[model samples]
Target: MGFFQLLMKKKELIPLVMFMTVAASGASSFAVYSLWKSDVIIDRKGNPEPWENVDPTVPQKLITINQQWKPIEELQQVRRATR
Candidate 1:
């Protein structure tokens, strides 16, 4: 069941739960994007320099989850079937 439906059943905690959910969603998404964003160093002319390298530990893909592979593989299969 969806969160809104769940909250509707509860009635009293609806506002509280919704507010918390919205705040949590915004905060987490923004915080995660900021943390993983490319930290390129710009020069005085507003050009990014090659010297500004991301740490080796930083991931190329923003998302940490490995579950995305399943869908990607499924898509490839679908594409082949359509040919």
Candidate 2:
């Protein structure tokens, strides 16, 4: 028999099939809306910040050296001794 004839014979499954169709359509519609909104937001934000326009005269710290490994108590003692 055809698919529609089978469905007609089993009347209880019609509501379940209809509910699934509605749920699937709603989920897909929501997904499309979300994608559209994301695109609109990205377009509105415009181009990203340019990195090439940085001031060359500004002093920049290129390297940091932490050579000392003194304990907190020793540091305090050293500060008192210096004073």
Question: How well does each candidate superpose onto the true structure, as a TM-score?
Answer: 0.35, 0.45
| Tens-digit per-residue lDDT, 9-77, candidate 2 | 999989999999999999999777665432234443453433233343443333435444434788669
Given candidate 1, what's the lDDT at residue 76? Answer: 62
Q: Which candidate is the best by lDDT?
A: 1
Per-model root-mean-square deviation over C-alphas: 15.0, 18.5
TM-score of 2: 0.45
Q: Which 10-residue span in candidate 2 carries the lowest summed lDDT?
A: 47-56
Off by over 4 Å in 1: 1-10, 40-83
Off by over 4 Å in 2: 39-83
Q: Which ten residues in a row have the lowest lDDT in candidate 1?
A: 47-56
